[model samples]
Structure formats: structure tokens, C-alpha cells
Target: MTVTPPPSRSAGRVATAVERASSALGRLRRGRLLHPAGRSFVGETVIWGTPGPPSGVALLDQPGRYRTTVRLSKGTPTPGSWPDVLGLALRLHHDDGRPFDLLVSSSGAAPGLRNLPLPRRRFTGTYSTITCYRAGRRRLWLAVLADPDSVDLGRSLATAVAATRTDTPRLVLAVASAVGPWRLVGQVSLGAQLSAEEDAALAFDPVRNLPPELRVAGPLAWLRDQTYRGSRRARGATAQSGGSTATTV
Candidate 1:
């Protein structure tokens, strides 16, 4: 039919875009969200496994469709008080709009203090462009930047995503700007993964089981804060900056 030509081409374009997205997602869903090699620098590594994870843990609220790990220096993340022990590697796998599984690794980096509104760099922002899947029971975080300090959080989260991509192979971190909020969703555990006589050059004695200037806290507190508070409270859901709200949950 005369009208069929344009529609066919339009469908082709849509199909191509879908194929690209699918291919990328498939790779994300399959590979190691956090490579073991990248995590050699963390002080204490907590691995949240598939099919029954650690107790008091919400990640099991949903199934870990894909397995991965993230190493982070755990502590209370406030503005100006603490430092990012190491740059983190955060990789998430999406399965049907939920972040089915996630892997994140951390390494310490003194990004230096900034005078931003919230000292967000002192805190880490874990954000993603497209979150296709989430673990059931696990919380979702959406960060909306409205005040002076919040935008710094957005930038920090973006940096975390970028660092994660560089730590692994064939990994891509998607960053996009939407109208309402920027979201960070997942059930990835926090803390660092240790190795035998590790090689990354953080000169801490392993036997002490203590990392210098490093403290531990519950896993994924930031994510939990967003998942429970942000999504439910319209304020959290609609927290924004620059005439828009950016969310991470």
C-alpha cells in the first residue's frame, strides 16, 4: 500500500533502537557487575549473594536475577566530615524495570573538599540513566536536586557511575536528564572486598581487621533512605534542582 513505506521505515528505526538497548542490557544482566580484580582495595568487602543474602538485608526482598558485587568504604556520609576512601565501581543489571542484581566496588580517593551547597562530594551519589529492573523488596532511590547542595550529590552520583564503567570490561553507565527526577535503584551491598596480600597499595595491615580512618555502617543506607522516603513522599519523588527535581532511589 502507498502509506506502508514510511511506517515500515519508522518501525525499522524503532527496532534498531530496541536492539541496541537489548544488547546493552543483556550484557549488563550477564557479566560481573563488580569485577573481583577491581575490588582489591577495599577495607572490608561484603558480598550479598543470590538466593538468600545476609540477614536484616532488604536486597532479598527481590530476587537477584544477576549476581554482582560493589566495594565501598562504609561510614556515615555527611557533607564535609568524611572523604571518599576510594572511587567506587557500581554496576547494575536490569530485568524488567527492576534492578535485578547489582555489583559495586570501592576505592578511596580524596577528591578534595568543595564548597557546594551540600558538600555532596563528601557523600556519594549512586545514580543510573536507565534502571530496567530492581530486586523485589529492595528499595528504590530517586534524588531530586533543588537546593544548592543537592546538585553536588547529582554530580557525585554521576562520578560514581563513571568510575564503575572504567573498572570493568564492556560496561556502560547511562546518564540522562529527565523532567522530574534522577534515580539510583538497586540492592547492591556496601563495603570493600579484601584479598590475600593485596597489591593495590593501601598500606593497611590485614590482620588488624581495621582500616585506617575507615568506619563501617549498615549497607546501602543512602539507597534505603531514598527508597523508603523519596518514593513515598511526593517531595522526595519530586525533589529537583535547576527548575527540575532529580531523584536517586
Candidate 2:
């Protein structure tokens, strides 16, 4: 698949500058810049093959397990609270030394549900991105379906990584698209969780570590760099100010 190049270098620089300015303002008001104030955790999950026939997308072609780390946060930095937008950032490591990074925000799961006001949710709720991947000529989205009664379990998965200590709870990664209905594509099982400090230092950039097959498109893709770049600027400012440290959001 042919992926379009990112925004021009000049546009990127301008976006980065705007992001730095926003970080500066955040720093001035809060005394320290917290790019994203949300719960973070690490786990292990398998990206199972799509049900039925092959999708023709090389990355979505088979059963694959990955060591995963997820940073869950709100769109607005609400302290210990959820809001209109839910940000779920994923980094997957494979056995062949390749890494897959995906950053998606929860808006609406279905095509008809697009742009509708999202209800408030906690750390335990399911998060999804609408139509993110390209499967040959088709577009699709991935969702992490969480159990209704699994709120505490979800939080626990983030705090510690011990595979739930009993039954290894499975989370489904469903792929959906405008052309077709949702399809079960992959599964994730948490093995270990990252420490709070490690989580704080983790950087989740879909662009930097993403696989070649999964490229973000549309206007949202252009704005993604501004976010990472701004968070980076904020981290630098915080370090220079001798305040608390952060890596990315």
C-alpha cells in the first residue's frame, strides 16, 4: 500500500512551534506541564487473525501475539476523570524485533455514530477508533471491547502486570469499516504491567514507531504530530524548570 507523506517540513515546524507555545502556557498556569493526566499500564495481548477469509492486508493476515503497553487518558487533562474524548495509545512488540505503535481516540465506533456526543466513561470502559486501517482497498477501525463488569479488572491491569493472577482476561480487538460490519481481528492478554514511573516515562507516538502497513490518513493525521511535538516541548520545559518530569502523552 502506498502511504502519503506527512505534512511538509515547514508546516511541521509551524505546528511544533504552536505546540510549544501551548506547552508554555500550560506550564505557566500549572507550574508544571502534564501532557496527559491519565492512567497507564502495560500488558500482553494477541492480535488474532480476522475471522473467516483473509483481509489481504499483510499485517492483519494472521494470528499474532504482542507484548503491549497502553496509555489511557482523556482528551482534556481532567484530573483523575474521564471526558468527551478517550485516548488509547498502544505499542506492540513482536518476536521478530519489529514494533507497532497505534494512537487512537474514542469518538464513535460505527459510521452512523460518528461525531455524536460521547458519554462519560471510566478507565474500565471500551475504547475504539473509527476506520483507521487500510486493508487493500478497504478502511477499518480497531476496538478494545471491555466487559461491563470489568471496570476494576481494567484498572488493575494498568497498575500491575501479573496476568490477572487467575483467569487471563481477554480483550477483543475488533476491526470495523464503512464498507462492512465489524469483524473480530485480534485479542490481547495482559501478562505484566509497567510501574508508575515507567508508565510516566513512556512515550506513545503512532508516527514514530508505527508499522509501515498501518498508516494514518486524513486531516487528523496532520494534527497528530502537533500533539507529540507539543508534549515533547512541555517535557523539555519542565526539565529545564527543575520540575517533575514527563516523556510523552
Candidate 3:
């Protein structure tokens, strides 16, 4: 049997430093360091199963529908008409009632560029996982593409909020290998808007909330977990001052 070695002491030290810095920033901001301001909505996710090769994730291999909560935000607080990295976070419930969180950000759709975040003027652009997820022996990436039938969303956060007020926003959920084309696997339809308090109280951690078949591995996952732990701890400490401490899913 093949065994993976543990991270080196130097790597561990760097991860620790990253956790500490992230914790401090989370405390300073009293919320998310990136994507502080966002809009949340009640949504539904429908899986159609991929038409191409099996993704190895049962959720995407079989057809299913689930209730979901979605959050859309900008990575950097850019003003009106300015381009900024957009974020899309989805929270879904597993069959056994555990939360499955999936977070993606505006990024390239091509092979070499998929991991790179790209500033987008509109919320209708593509959003990528940025990191690959392990599905058995294979690694795959996920993405969300705006449905062509959906209304055209503008550049500003306010515009997106306002547009969703009147129109139901729809997105296509797709998956692919590192250098493969995206294959449609599901659809996401967002409905009613969530209150500011509700939005603020929502916290997403993909590292902890994923399914067994689809694992987030590697040193990057370790770093991500630490960062998320630090942020959650810092925010929990000051939860009473702002949003509720209760995490929805």
C-alpha cells in the first residue's frame, strides 16, 4: 500500500502563521475579510447527472434535487461600474442532513486559467472552484455558469440585489477535469432574498462540509482549513455584537 507523508515542520509553521494572520484579520473586520458585504437568497439545486464521464461523486452521478441557500458577493469592495472578483457560495443538505458547502469565485473557464480569479463586471459571468477536489483517484473542478435565459445582471452589488428582486436568477452547475471541457451536471435557481441579519449569520466552509466521495486534499486544503477555523473562532467571539451566532447549515 502507498502512504502519504506528513507535512514538514516548515510547512506546518507557515500554515500556523497563516492561521494567526487570518484570525487577526477576521477579528479586525468582525466578519469576513474578503466578501464582507453580500446578498443571500433561498434557492434550489437540481442535479441532472453528467452526460460525459462519471465524476465519482454520487451527488453528481445521480439525479437529485435539494433546497439550497446562496450568497453572492464581491471579493474586493469595488465601487459602481468597477470590475471585482465575484463570489458564489452555496449551502446544500446531504441526505443524512449534514451541510455540504460549495464556494466558488469568478475565474477563467479554460484549462490553465481555471485556477486564476478574474475580476468581472457582471454577476452573470463564470465562477470556478479555484481548487481541485479529489474524486477517488481523479481530480476535478466545479463551476457555475449563468444561464443564458436569465436576466442580464449589472456590475454593481446593488444592481445584482435589485435585479434578483424581480427576476429569478438561474445558473448551470458544471464539472470538469484539470484540462477538460465543462460538462453540465446540475442547475441552480435562486428565489427570495434573505434579510441582512440572515446573510451575515451565514458561514461556509467547503473543507469541512464536503462529502466522502469528493474530498479536498493537499497542503492547500490544510491551509484553507486553518484559515477557516481561525476566521470562525474570531467571528464567534464577537458574534453578539453583530450578527447572530447561529450558523444556518
Candidate 4:
């Protein structure tokens, strides 16, 4: 995959404006810009040995397994009964002491309306991403596979306990590692449920934290960091205020 050049001056200006607006919006909400409240889970990921041919990217070239943590939530400050974006954030701890984080939102449930503001069907099961990234000359994406019914409980504090099941949740990342076929990598299993406080402290900044091999070079890449900065600033401000970083589910 050819690397797209960085954003131009005009695009930079627009990104800056969006970031500022996002920060303002977060302050107004007095919480995270998105997925402010969520249930946490500890799990693990296991990459298949024959995942695919060598991808050139070191992370995906070899098969491996690791521990992971996940946060499941509705993208908006609403109840699960409502139609809204579903969210899944993951943190994978590799054996080499590398921690990779991923954040994904559910797509529209209907065909041709994937871009619509529809909630992801069956919040508890699977999550995939159409967004592609450049790894050297290769392009890739990621996915997290799970049983949507793994925890069918509602989005309430009481129901959050259901996520801490005896079975550990695993992270399944789908990456188009090589030119051949899209393969899954970085599978990690989740363990326990994190307390509200612990969840609040965990942050996923893709641009800042993504591994160098997973180089971001698509047309929309420039906007990723800018868009997230607003939320990061807002979250920081909320924490400093000693306010509830997340709304009570």
C-alpha cells in the first residue's frame, strides 16, 4: 500500500477546529467525549500459528497470545435500550511487555447504511473495523470476535457484573497483514472486571500508542489524533475537577 502524504495546511486548520470543538463538547458534557460509562473485562488473545504468510510487519509475522482488558459501552450517554453506537476498547499486553490498545465503535446494523448512526446489532458479540492502515507497503484493519450473547445483560451497574464470567474474553484483531488475505492477529484473553475508578484511568490513543510497524497513512489518518485530543483534554479536566468521569450506568 502506498503511503498517503500528511494533511495539507487547509486540512490541518480544519482538524484543529474539530479538535477544539470536541474538547468544548466534552466539557459541556462534563465527561468523556464518547463512551463515558462502560463495563470492563480482563481477557486474552491468541493468534493462530498459520494466520497467514509473512506480512513484513513484525507484530503480525509470528503467532502469539497475550493478556488483555476490554471496556464495553454505549457510545452515547443513554441506556442500552436506545439505538446508539456501541463501543469496545481493548488493551493487549504482549509477552515482550508491549501493550497495544484498540478502540472500535459498532457499525450500522442495516446494509448500505453502515455509515448511518445506527447502533451495532447485538452489543455483546463481535466487532469489526473497515478502517485500513498502512504497514510498510501493506494495508490492514482489525477485528474483535466474541459471542454477542456472551453477556446479554442490560447496561446497568448491576448487569455489569455479568461480564466477569468464568470464561475469559479474548481479543481477535483482524489485520490485512499481507497482500494475500486478511488474517487475525494479537488475540488476548480478558480476565476480571475493573472497578469504575480503574476503567476511568485507562485511555486508548491510537495515534500516540500504535506500534511503528502499524503505520497510519490513509487519507483520513491526519484527523485521528486531532479528533481524540479534544476528548483527552476533556477527560483530563473532568478528572481534575473530581467529578464523575463516567455517568452512572
Candidate 5:
């Protein structure tokens, strides 16, 4: 049996701070603290083995296709076409019927910058997990990049919403070691937009919804878990439902 260590005092303090901040922000906004506004889509994820070493997580090491619900949002409520840190929240069902959520934000793809969030005016940029996940004894990072062949939609929320009206948007999923180049793992194709009510009811929690093989550990994970709990509490929302009724195209 493996015993997990308790979080450090400093980690506890940081978690508390993050929780309080997220709660306050959510209350002030009367909804989500971070991605206050967003468009939701029904989609699918197609996964396959990468070229490099396996991530040790069965989901990434094997081939699979899963239904997904995705949300695209601006981190800050930046007005109109202004640049803002973008966010992507993806929810899918594992083979065992558990829901797995992955939250990503606009970030760099290169080493030394992959963990840093960057503002963008278009939806066609890189989005990263911004934190590490433990896959066995190795640390891994995940990213989603816009498919170069896809349309380069404009910055405004309206543009993104409108584009989905006519066509589906696609993003390439990749994974990497602590400092290695990214290896292609899968693809996410977002289809029809979800209704406002459906979008409002959806809450993503990657920290709680992850698989056993891919553990979210350390201070950053603690902070994120607390922050997510606080946000949901302030908004009176619960974890995402495994059986989503949203319509897909």
C-alpha cells in the first residue's frame, strides 16, 4: 500500500488564501469568479498512443473515443475584442463511468513558459494545464493547441459563438514530460453550442475528477482544489453530472 503525505503548513495557508479569494470573487460576480462568461459545446475526444513514452495513464496510453462537453471562456471579463487569458474546460466520462474533467487556460507551449498564462485575442492559440500531474513516478503536462487548418476565429465572444453556428472547431491535444517536447495524443472536436441554462448548470473540477493513475499532487493542486470548492460553494453549484443531457450536433 502507498501512503500519501499530508500537505505542508505553507500549502495549507496558500489553499486558504486561494479559497477565500475565489469565494469573494464569485460572490462579487454573482456567478463564476474566473471564467464568468463562456460558451459551451458538445463534443468528442479521440485519443491514441503518442509517439514517445507512454504517460502511464491508461487513458492516454490506449486508443479511445469519448463524448465530451467543452466550454470556452475569457479568464477576465475583458470587453469586446480585447485580449484576455482564455480558458477551456472539458468534461468526459472514463471507461469505468467516472467523470473526468480537464481545465486548461491560454499559455505558452515552450519550456520555461508552459506554466505561465498568456492573454490572447483569438481562440486559435495554445492552452495548457499550467500545472503538473503525477503519472507514476514522472511529472506530466497537457496542452491543447488550435488545429492549424481550422478557421482562425476572431476574439469577441460573439464571434466564437457565431462560428460554432456553422462549423465545428477542432483542437489538438498533446502531452509532455517535465521539460520534453510535446507529443500528440488526441484531438477534441467541439460541435453545437449548449443552451445558457445547460452551460450554467455545468461545473468542472479537474482536481476531484481525475483518474487514479494521474494524480494531481503538491501545493498547486491543493490550492486549485480549494479554489474550485470555494467557487462552487459561492455559486451554489455542484460537481458536473456524468450524464449530461445537452444536445450535440
Candidate 6:
């Protein structure tokens, strides 16, 4: 079957991100997401992931409805190189008048939502990308989004990241679903402009924040990375032994 590959994200990353975002949203909702009215947040968590082919390391999860791809390619393609695989798990839930749900949450960041820094400004209504350097082991030189005159992008992002208590996250959810209609209740919506009160409240949400124990890349993530590296080493060994295996994501 020919996969359309929505948003350039490969299969693996999409599932992981969606799962994380969904779970986090669920925990935070507490029956608060669904409202009595028809209006709702532009985007919110709705469905969890469905299973896919049982591949190595649970990378390619298939919800059938979602479009996923691999983020990291085999070789170091480019500096700002968006991986062949990424995480694309969003649906255009609403498009009545305004395009509000520009970015939504995913599931893998569960219990923790994937957030992209929104430019705080009186925007002229133009989409723009910002080049920034992340200071961490990954030290990723990635693109961020912001407004023309929004100088507080960094601070806002820092506050949000600090609110969630997570390290620099690579993928920010651009769209997602909610348990019910958040707009109806006039409650918190995933894509709504967060107020200071809402930010403060979410900063401490048990589900929104990751436990200190799971703070850093846990053993599983480490294992996945190490195992990936080890596989490369093993491949090298095989190459030396005059045997070969073609790796594919």
C-alpha cells in the first residue's frame, strides 16, 4: 500500500507522540474536557492509538487513521534536516471561521502533552519559522515558530517547558482531539490561549507533569538508543564477516 505520509512524519514517531499527548490530556480532563454546549477547544485529545504491525521497539504503531513516519534518518542528512520519520497525529477538527487549532497534543508525551512555543503577539496573521539552538546533549538546531516582533518567545517557551517539567522536546503537536467538546463547557481547550491561572494550574497537574523518576530519558529510551547503536555495531561486525543486512525504518 502507498502511504501518503501526512506532514512528513514517519510511522514510528507519530504513534509515540500521539499516545503521549492523548494520555496526558485524558488525565488532565477529569470530566472537564467534555462540555454541555457544542463549542469546544479548537483541538483536544480524543482517541488513543491503535496497534500496528509488531515491529522492532514498537516504533510503527498503526492507528490506521493517523499518518506517521520515521523522524531520524539512517545517516546524518542535514543540520536542520527534518527526519524521514516524524510524528504526525492530527485531524482538522474544526474550520468554521478561524483556524484556531493550529497545534494540538499527541499521546506519547502522555500524561505529558507535546507543545510548540506559540508566538505571543498581535500577529499580522502570517506564519513564520525561527531558527534556534537547543542547549542539551542532543543540541538540536531546529526551527521554532513565533511572531515578527515577539521577543519573549524564549521566555514563553521556557515557562511552558518548566510548567510541564520536561526537557527540550523535539516535536510539538500541531493538532489533536479532545475527550469531548471543550468549547461547549467554556473550559480549557488544548489549543486555546492559556491564561496565567490555567498555566499555573497545569504546571502542577500530576498527569501533565512527568514524575522526577521518569524525568530524564529512562532506561527504555536509553535502551532503544543503545540498542539502535548496538545494531549498527552488529551490522559492522557482519560487514566485516562478509555478511550483510539492510536496515529499514
Instruction: Supply the TM-score for candidate 3.
Output: 0.89
Query: Evaluated with lDDT, which candidate comes out highest?
Result: 5
Q: lDDT values of the candidates?
A: 0.26, 0.54, 0.79, 0.58, 0.80, 0.21
Candidate 5 lDDT over residue span 70-150, tens digit each = 889988869887899989888876656667799999998897888899998887888989988888798999899888887
Which residue runs does candidate 5 get wrong by more than 4 Å?
A: 1-21, 241-243, 246-249
Against the true structure, candidate 2 reaches a TM-score of 0.72
Q: Against the correct fold, how does model 6 do in TM-score?
A: 0.18
Judging by TM-score, tell me the better candidate of 4 and 5: 5
Model 2 C-alpha lDDT per residue in residues 1-249, reported as the tens digit of each score: 233435575765666676777667645654223335544555555656777766665556677666676655666655444344666666776556546666555556566763232545544455666436654576666667654433244332233233354444456666666546667777655433445566556665555455555666665555654555566555553211111122211
lDDT of 4 by residue, 63-104 (tens): 665555667777764764565677777665544544666766
Off by over 4 Å in 1: 1-64, 73-86, 91-121, 124-177, 183-185, 196-249
Model 2 CA deviation exceeding 4 Å by range: 1-13, 22-35, 79-84, 95-98, 114-117, 147-169, 236-249
RMSD of 1: 19.4
> How do all the candidates rank in terms of TM-score, highest first?
5, 3, 4, 2, 1, 6
C-alpha positional error of residue 242 in candidate 4 after TM-score superposition, expressed in Å: 16
Clashes of each: 48, 7, 0, 17, 0, 40
- Ranking of all candidate structures by their lDDT, best first: 5, 3, 4, 2, 1, 6
Models 1 onward score TM values of 0.23, 0.72, 0.89, 0.75, 0.90, 0.18
Tell how far residue 142 is off in model 5, in angstroms: 0.2
Cα deviation in Å at residue 175, candidate 1? Answer: 8.0
**CA displacement after TM-score superposition, residue 65 of candidate 1 (Å):** 3.0
Q: After superposition, how far is residue 25 of candidate 1 from its true place, in Å?
A: 34
The list of candidate 3 runs beyond 4 A from truth reads 1-6, 10-14, 237-249
